[model samples]
Target: MKNSIAILLCVSIFFIQCKEADSNSKKPTVYTVGDSTVKNGQGDGAAGLWGWGDFINQFLDTTKVKVKNHALGGTSSRTYIQKGLWKPVLDSLKKGDYVLLQFGHNDDGPINDDFRARGTIKGIGSESEEIDNMLTGKHEVVHTYGWYLSKIIKEAKSKGAIPVVMSPIPRNKWEGKKVPRNNDSYGLWAKQVAAREHVTFIDLNEQMAQKMETLGEDKIYGNLFYKKDHTHTSAKGAVLAASIITQELKKTNNSLKDFVLENPTIILPKKTNIYLIGDSTVANNGIPEAVGWGVELHKYLDTTRVNIINKARGGRSSRTFYNEKLWQAVYDTLQKGDFVLMQFGHNDGGHIDQPKYRGSIQGISDSTMVVTKNDSIKETVHTYGWYMATFINQAKEKGAIPIVFSHIPRNEWKGNSVERADKTYGLWAKQIAQKNNAAFIDLNDSISVAYEKIGAKKIKQFFPKDHTHTNADGASFNASIVVICLKADKSLGLRDLVLSQKEIDRLSQIALNTSIENKK
Candidate 1:
């Protein structure tokens, strides 16, 4: 009897300890998978496009949830999982986690055996696969794109994670000057599969197409794409994509409905803090009418939900930014989930006359060159590449999302044709961003588009005779461009920062009235 009582007591103690351990454990995470539209990439300049995932961080209650981005550039649903890219996610997934999948940008590759091919015509090929070591260099079997996606869904579900399928956001491409319906494209197919599998779905492509139509083609350009390029999004374009997804989530899932940041919150500040660390164009100049994009950026933001901290200094290159410890001030104060905007190059041209002051080394590539401070002596300066990249990597190390923008345009560009960075510091900035896996905003491309639409006569009002800097009007104009870029790119994490239609109309009216009063 004594032995039986002792054994029973020990079993009860073990059960209680197990329950305690389980209760204290952290919850599983949510992950995303997609292509270039959703993937993070460098913007045209150092200060532009905003990614959707960046803003998604704002919507979730961080205490109980975690989000991971597994999206990449130039990938389709077929290649994303095939290249072992999905392995890391699969390995890390735990029960009760979630996977959000979006694709379709590059899935329409040639039907033949091209290296980039991802999908074939519907019902054109056999469903089964056979081992063929001769045809494939490595793998013995090749599965259809649908098959691969199904595998991901099955695997995720098997691990007790919910798989939510979202169609790719539509490109800015138009037919007859109107945004086309996504009736037959991959966007349509994504819906069909979601329905067939009874998985949750978000039709981002449909939403984006309708959004562009609602905004109008002329109004959509700079806000969506930097140029006539219909495929990729400008910084604003990314934000728009993210907003559609975010709003859709509120509609799609009841559990997440209350968590939307747009809903009034009595609990805490519940705002996302953004810190800017860059050269003149993205930093606050504080000079009237001579504001940089960073300085004028406040007009587009909802201050109640976001805190903007600008630490940009003029005449500072990447090297000077660090040497002066300007970034340290921002870094020391940043909280987790905060964002950092980085732009440089107007001064990083490596001018060596101020030899003691330049940031990057000279004579590395056309992208990075040594500039002599004075014509008399050829004193080598730092490479713009080296100094700029260091700032980006450091910001990432600090656990902040680092968004780099291409340098804004100069008066040197004469026409609607975009002045490619060529061998200049701007080109180097773009290359360095891509190499580092940092989010990039093509400010150069975005600004040029705005300039073209406003026309050279109207542009003179914004840009001074020198063409490099802008007046207050120009600064505000540029700020609008940055906001538009944030809306379309979906990479800078500004999706949750969108203003509703009523809010947008109100701001636009306020701006118009302010302009009219100034004219008077």
Candidate 2:
């Protein structure tokens, strides 16, 4: 009876060990490899740039499997393997692990150049060429792009791991109505390799291109690419690309699809505030008949998403606005994700240090002027550009986006065309925005364009009593024009927060009718 009991205990222990081992083996991981678009610097999304590999985990089921992004920037199919970057990744793969491969952006460089030397022979042919390594000073044989990709697939499969081949994401190059794709080159070869190897394939290039077509060139260029670079993606673009990959993975028959999250919560951003600041042209004149563009701007905005705060005061220049503690109040209430629209220059053209000391020096120079206030207190004033720059830099420090607008044009016309301030304050405001990396709107030029289109005689109705101040109807018209400008500006990200085109048209017509009524 004792011998039988001991045997039964040993059998129970053996079965429990087997079950634990089996459970451990079932826990798989998905590994990613490719170029900069797959993974950029440190993969932390620094400097407004990002890569899809860093963001894919958000849509994955981490409880089921882990995700590891092993991609390196500036690496191609040839160099990635040649430089021993793929060896560690391959060594880490287990029986149930999955690998995702993407390349091609850096594969088109010179084959033996010292700077990069990342190029691979075109096509999936078995052809290879001997070349002297410019960086390592060793003789090496470079294979075709297809050969490099095939090697990865074969090695993964040999290790009992599933391989998913993906075509490189498309660049921000557009051809007419659509973004051009790479279906003829790397994309075609990648798909062929997957089919030849009997592995799952994803057309990431085609998918991203289709998405780009839907987003249009404006959103793609403004929101996706890093600055003027068409290759790398910004944080927003990277998230979008990762989301696309998640969707494609769900369509596959592989076991990895079971690890994708279903109905993941999409986080919406908090509401933003839009603050307007400038001179009389942007202020709320107390009289109902006399108004400013700032007062009427809220009518064209989506109040649910953004609150328009017109903080502009009449007869206040950039210097006075900063010195009088008006800017301090606005700055105190400013918060992250807020927007400041600054338009000054109408009241910044007065003489300095002579009783009415309101004017500031021109240009972006660091020049200063001494002035006496009403209380006989002496103060030093900086250039007009300096004050504007101060406002821009302060807003940026407070995590708010500052947009500079040129002062509206006076009721002055040279022949059939309305004169513009593009040479003076308009030009200076644009310079300040560029220097400070802020968004700029040429309100002076935009209003002038409308006036020129309407002709000098008919456009005079916009100015009721003075050339600098507009009547209520004219304020609404200018405000609608500002809305049009915001819609056209891709970098502002304010298109969705504005009223519909139909509403804008209706408001414009109403303003025109009011103008006629006021004239009568």
RMSD of each: 14.0, 12.3
Model 2 CA RMSD to the hidden true structure, in angstroms: 12.3
Best by lDDT: 2
Best-matching candidate per TM-score: 2
Candidate 2 lDDT, tens digit per residue, 1-520? Answer: 9999999999999999998778766779889999989898888654445688887877887767888999999999999998899999899899989998999998888889788898999999999999898977889999999999999999999899999988999898888879888899999999998999999999999998898898888767546763246888876678788888889988989888887888765432245699999988889879765588998887777553467998999888999999888999999999988999999998787877765678888887899878777898999989889999999999998999899999988889888877888888999999999999999999899988987877776667878776768888889989999999998897887886776678887997798777877777
How high a TM-score does candidate 2 get?
0.57
Query: What is the overall TM-score of model 1 with all chains considered together?
Result: 0.47
Which pairs clash in model 2? none
Point out where model 1 deviates above 4 Å.
Answer: 1-25, 42-51, 111-117, 120-136, 253-259, 262-520
- lDDT (Cα, tens digit) per residue for candidate 1, span 1-520: 9999999999999999988667545555768787766655632222334345544545666556677777776777766876788888888888878788887777776433536545434421337444333323554355555556667888887887788888777767778667776657666777777776667888888888888888888787556764335676655576667667768888776344344567422232356778887776676676665567777677677554577888888778877787678877877786667888777877766544565556566423434444545556553445677666677777777787877777788755555554656467666777888888887778877878767765665566555536677656666666776667777777666854654435444554454345445555
The residue-level lDDT of candidate 1 at 502 comes to: 51
Candidate 1 lDDT for residue 136: 38
